[model samples]
Target: MPPRYSYWTIILNGTATSFRSATRDELIPTLYQLKKLDPKAVLKWFARGRLWESPSEARAAAQQRRSRTRTGAKETSRDRNWRPGGTHRDPKARTAERKKVTRGHRTNSERGRPKGGKVH
Candidate 1:
């Protein structure tokens, strides 16, 4: 028999899997069927002469592109949260607020030293 859809492809575990659907809405059901066959197998979608990470990702991208074209607006740039000169906080204040931990401290030179003198 001839294929129902004009273009559709599904891959699971590096092998092509058979599925029949006449509309894009079949993507979700196809994904679920693949999951049942092999939950841990790698899933992929081949459509529009391009490879996609998953069927859902391709659908989402298509929806997003449609919305953007409908609005006919360019994406706006965002301003940086920082200034060019330097950080807002003062270095001196940060050092003053820092605490020194001296409990159970032993320097490398002080370690393994005898009470008499240095060991030759």
Candidate 2:
């Protein structure tokens, strides 16, 4: 009896198919040959969610996906006014906002004699 572990589930030509391979290493070359023989036979790595022309491409894509996931990127913005590559204080916008805040600025005592008509 053949080992059940030899069976691999794969997507080919947009259809789910299965083939028994002695090892994943062996299956990669077979998929390469199949795609070469038939353009419609788009060999896909369902585990990684991508189509592959060769084993090297599949390996590279998987590595890239792993690198991106490990980069600690935020899935959603949890901050207000958030832009991809900007900080809270933009130079041009920062200077413009500063002028407004300072133009009419007053300190506590400067705000009007401590608010009770008394100057100590």
Candidate 3:
């Protein structure tokens, strides 16, 4: 007889359909469910690379999303400038803002650390 489906398995299927992609957390629960259903099936899927997104593709997608979320030019001048109670009071504050915005999301280790630990 076929194994019974668990709640997590059902949730994962639903979420995957809605997102059109599965995050690690989303996949994990499904993996557990699959394991419970059939360990061999889980292993086979992994072997076929049906589990996770390619690292490069995932990174690019995240960057694209971040860029899309930034405030558009339609924002008021006050919104573009620092709020009275906010940080960044300096006239050159935009430089810092640009750096903060463009800075890679990953740390050195993630980007491949330098041999000497000094940033070029």
Candidate 4:
């Protein structure tokens, strides 16, 4: 059978459709089916760069493409807690505070080893 919609039409529709309502995942399977039906259709879409429109769509497509391309079933960590600039506090600050608290117990010689001796 002939294709239901052209590749460009689908890509444009994906971008024009509302982000919340758009069914972006549908594109890959549709493309796959189209590829099976007509290899030329898939090549045509690639030649025109009509696969994905936005960066988000491109990223999603890349991930999907990778998953399909790969053979092994790998486990991926979904932990989102690890991120830069989101540290609870400066660990050095805590360590410095502890050092400062115990610092008074030490003699001047033990603290910095002054060349001229302790500064009484």
Model 2 segments more than 4 A misplaced: 1-13, 20-39, 42-45, 77-120
Residue 41 lDDT in candidate 3: 33
lDDT of 2 by residue, 9-119 (tens): 445667766643434665667667777776665433333444454556767877986887789774564666555576754457878779869897666677666766657
Order by TM-score, highest first: 2, 1, 4, 3
Native-referenced Cα lDDT, model 2: 0.59
Task: Put down candidate 3 lDDT per residue, 8-118, tens digits, no spaces.
Answer: 222243233222222345656556666576554331111122333354554566577667667454334564556565584765777877886797456667768875676
Clashes in candidate 1: how many? 0
Count: clashes, candidate 3: 0
User: Which 10 consecutive positions of candidate 2 have the poorest summed lDDT?
Assistant: 42-51
TM-score of 3: 0.21
- What TM-score do all the candidates reach, one by one? 0.29, 0.31, 0.21, 0.24
Reference-based lDDT, each prediction: 0.61, 0.59, 0.46, 0.49
Error of 1 at 83 (Å): 45
Give the clashing pairs for model 1: none
lDDT of 3 at 93: 71
1 versus 3: better lDDT goes to:
1
lDDT of 1 by residue, 45-117 (tens): 5655555766677778889978997797667543554334577445566555453233555554668777775
Question: Each prediction's Cα RMSD?
Answer: 15.6, 9.1, 21.5, 14.2
| CA deviation > 4 Å runs, candidate 1 | 4-42, 73-120
Pairs of colliding residues, candidate 3: none
